[model samples]
Target: MKSMMMLMLLLFLMPVQAGTPISEYENLLITEVVVTPTDAEMIEIHNKGGVTLDLTDVYLTDATFSNGNVYYYQVVSGAGGGGDFNDFFARFPNGASIAPGAYQTISINGSDNFFSTYGVNPTYELFEDGAGADTVDDMVEATPGSIDDDPGGTVAGVSALSGGEVAVLFYWDGNSDLVQDIDYVVWGDKREAVDKTGISIDGPDADAITSVYLDDTVIASQAVINASSHAGGNSWQRGNLNEGNETGSNGNGVNGDDETSEDLNNTFFEGLPTPNAAAGAPPAPNLIINEVDAVSSGGEFVEIYGSANTSADNLSLVFYDGDTDQVYQVIDLTGSSTDSNGFLLVGNTGLSPDVTIADDSLQDGADAVALYNIDASAFIVGDPVTVNDIMDALVYDSGQADDAGLLTLINPGQSQIDEGSNGNAANESMARCPNASGGSLNTSTYQAVDPTPGVLNSLCPLGDYYATADDTNATTLRNTLHEIIDDHIVFPYSAGTTDTWDVLSFADEDPNDSNLVWMIYKNNSYTWKGGGQQAYNREHTWPQSYGFSSGSLGDDNAARTDAHHLMLSDVTYNGNRGNLYFDDCNAGCTELTTDVNNGVGGGSGTYPGNSNWFDGDSFEVWNFRKGDIARAMFYMDLRYAGDVSGEVDLQLTDNPGDIQTGQPFMGLLSVLIDWHNGDPVDSIEQIRNERVYSYQGNRNPFIDHPEWVECIFVQGGACTTVGDDLIFASDFD
Candidate 1:
């Protein structure tokens, strides 16, 4: 027999087949790298991976130029974008991984200039000053196969060389003086010593500028010197190209007739004669026109940018009616194809001209740019959404079904529950909001998360126990519990033995596991703290739904004994348990079993709780087997039935789920039938029965010492006080 038992136990303990590990690469990719005219010697590294890549150790270098040692740089973990300072360069704000195949652009400007012009022969560079021109000259490969445009396609040089209009890159030299200076000349015309549109000599106070001409017609330009605009000695220029805007009737040898009256076809960045130290915090997302594909009655194809270098990612923009305060839609602009000025080139589907027109030329949508301000009271660290608001939004945006798109943005756990999945969020939340006191559901019974001992993820320790002194009411309750447990309840330790349940201490080895800890819930979070002291809130076993009136449960004749249906419970569990009757299986039946000895030998006969009265129709006594049923039924009796007149019908229950009401008790009782072969004991149950004894306190002698079998029903079967008298006095009868 022992061998068979051991074999069965071993078989039960054997491990089940393991399931496949979840792959992180299951999500869909969203943003891709967008290339356009405004690329401007810049490149974005999109997160095309399944998870956020830690870019801290990731290397970025320029290896295209003839010079092997061009430039090198590194991206710090959280320093890149979205107003966050410590992110993995490979990742973004909120730990969101750049979606698989998504682009994460790294600009070759400001602090990131090294990657722009690191390796190049005839080298690629940004020339702030040219002796022959007044404006900064951006060297380009006017002739194909030129030196300035040569990328050598090297790992250290430019990533690409322009076939018709090559480009040059620049960086702030870190000179606090704000003085602009000539950096370097990268000639790409295949000519080692070309004229290169060099800046001409400048007179005192005259700004020297370089101008490009095709058939004596200027098109693009950049500035080089700090000369007055009127006395332009040096002016900046785009590549050395001169395309006539349009040949006018008075056209001279010059395609357009007048040099100063030429059409501005090309683009240029005019360096202010004096740098404006106070540049309005570059417009939230300094967008620029990157490209313009097409423009017609149809929508336009434009791209916008949200870079990590800028503080723009923190913004939440909405499209609204220009005339009315009506809001349209919110957009995630961080990945929009845009230029440095926050304008999509035009014609991008995201920025279609038709959509723009429909929205009133972008001006209307501009009015919708209101901030989604955070409400301090509603805010939680991991999520920005409020419960009710999120629920409404989900209903509106996703229809009756769960919206995977919206869920993608919310915490996965919350999303699951919101979608009606039996995830832990709802359960956890309900379990954490119970009343602290073992009895009473009142304002004074409220408990909160403990603030001191400040363990972020762990529960409050016993020494720092807040409920003990949060208020006079809580203190009294604590005292009462101590007295009751010491006197009536027999703790394993109090019985001259070591307490088996010593897991309540924060010092427990598995402090992180809430299940292993006592006096706390499943999250390692405190069940109750002093009122308003921490994250916890007191829970009530007997809901105050019936009324808030309070009095002793046994005080049947008392006028104010209406609100006696309250007991402490975990906060989060309370929500999950919700409000319901305990009679889950059958009315008035509990799962509790009586000892065989008590049932047959008549030892200590009657069941606990005076609330259990003899009912000849069915059974002699009532007992709540399921803990939840007892709690819920108690709540209903004390709150609802006690306050208002109603049929006090018994409920049927089967242990369907964690109970918070009466009906479920009957179900639990059935479930425990197989295991019941001995005496049943529950301290709280004993107290309840004692209190309800004859609707009187301990002063009632008859209630204290009555016929043992008068009204008793043991686990084995039913018993009746009337039957017992007849059986005992059979001869007399």
Candidate 2:
């Protein structure tokens, strides 16, 4: 019943307006007025009236007192006009006009001597049902049902008890249309938590002032009655107040729902103990390219790639050696477009690949080898490869083979003659240098020999063969193939939409040239397949194996999880990536096997791969594309893996033993090594199952941009594409 009554009352009071009158002689309705300290030196007057009223001639007065005498003081010397819901006091200018009806206010610092001269004995009255400080009968004895009743009967009426002290009565008229608005009030040592209590009855007759009391004892005869003019009190209005703690809101009449000045703070903060305090700097991108080798004896360049995810002004790249004492240039990347947290940090190039690499065997100053296409001839024919050399190819060089004997065409064997020191051997007819027929072919473009200066040089030379061979016929054939899959490569899709494609005929019998993907928008359908994987298969460019999910898309979900699962995969070879996210989970074996046979099987009549690796231990089986898995996994890890200390509190290790024990997917490393060695498939079948791409789409971005892949390939002797001639010649060797 109380709740219902309060609800109804709230509804009724929601629309009530202050009933201040417009007459020149009418009294100003005072609203809320409060002083900060109990012994505040100055007083403030607040008017809660409904309309504009003049206070210029109106004076605040205080009744004074002596041993046996009483007095009063008129506080203001000049008359000032006050506006509706506003205020005017002796010290400060006018504020919001007093409204049309009930109001409450407070006053302080006015003269006390004048009250003694006017026969007004000052008293600190703690009122029960009250409105403003000016009312004579505003004080009442503590009542059982009154809203102002506190835990203790600490209420009292005005009666002078000591010098340097004063008090005033507050009243709320029962018949007034407006309830009094109280912020808080204080005078001398007396304080009250205001309740807008009032009488419901109307009367033209004056109400007698309640008897003055001292120390809980009533001095009935000393009580003074007030009707027309009350003294020592003033009223004012509340102006702009903001909605947060320690911060003031501005603008007129802008009150917070609660005392937000004592509450609420920064909305974005989490894990914070106090209001208005920040935790620390946000998480940064995890990228560490420890050492970059250009495989050249001359100076080489290296790049560290990742999003800074801060304002351009805050984007800085610092480079240092192992000791941290040797530092490189500090590059300011303030204007990069990839600074947007959502966009891929891109085009932030680093070193060129033309730098020379020194052989470990040769003396420090002996002849150095230059890196052209990731192959280093500085070392002996079969010297054990260095982690540094592999990282160099991964970080700075690309398009080189990962085998024992074949000389590299791009970074040729160390011989002056066209014939290699090893032999002229397995050189495949060169693919056109630019692959002009395919507008966006990946293997065609030159790698970024130097990124800081933004220069791209041609990859493998077309050589004199271009003038000797049927160049026109070859280009026409390549063009025809490009035309077949022209529209399938696009990027940047609207969120929450799927791109669909259909398998079609290809030039030659290239399986990668068959299928295409497209996005539907409005009435027209567009193909935005991007590169690599789009031309290959619906490869989870972000490997589905590492908890990557197709259904989740945002940073909070798919991008978050899949971001960790990136790697290159053959569309056909990815049969190994089966339905299993991770092969170690034992509880969901049946489900894993089923999912692999269904979604990832690619509807190929034959099961994805039936190698011994796929035997009965469901959790032990992996579904990666063995034919192309090594480079893919390397790319995936390079794309997403960063300094993860911030997110999962995990650490990264370069130790090979960690991949077999300390790491979660240690077993997969061996599988990848075997796949890279072509152990999963025989020579002919390995070549047949390889996934080729135009280098469009997120899946094949590294292959499309070998410069970026150089950072990774150099660290591991992993190769993605092999020249047919190189493979055949190595077989003969």
The best candidate by lDDT is 2
Error of 1 at 323 (Å): 96
lDDT by candidate, in order shown? 0.24, 0.25
For candidate 1, write residues 1-733 as lDDT tens digits.
9999999999999998542212222221111111122213432333323464432222222222212211111011111111111100111212222334443333322112323332211111222122343222232221122212325431222323121121111111112111111111111121111112222222223234322322322211211111112122112222112221323333221122322222221211222111101111212223221211111223322222222112223333333332333444444333323221122322324443212323223331112122222222333223322222221111111013443433332334332122111232111111011111211111121122221110111221122122222112323432332222221221111000111122112222223443332111112234322222234332333332322312212111121221112222234434443443222223443222222221221113334332222221122122422332233232232222222232232222344453333321222334323212222434433333332221211111111212211112123332222234765544455
How does candidate 1 fare on TM-score?
0.17
Error of 1 at 662 (Å): 14
lDDT of 1 at 434: 18
Model 2 Cα lDDT, one tens digit per residue, 72-180: 1111111112110111211111232333333323223222321322234222222322333543212222122121233454322122221122222222232222212
Each model's TM-score, in the order given? 0.17, 0.22
lDDT of 2 at 455: 18
- In TM-score terms, which candidate is top? 2
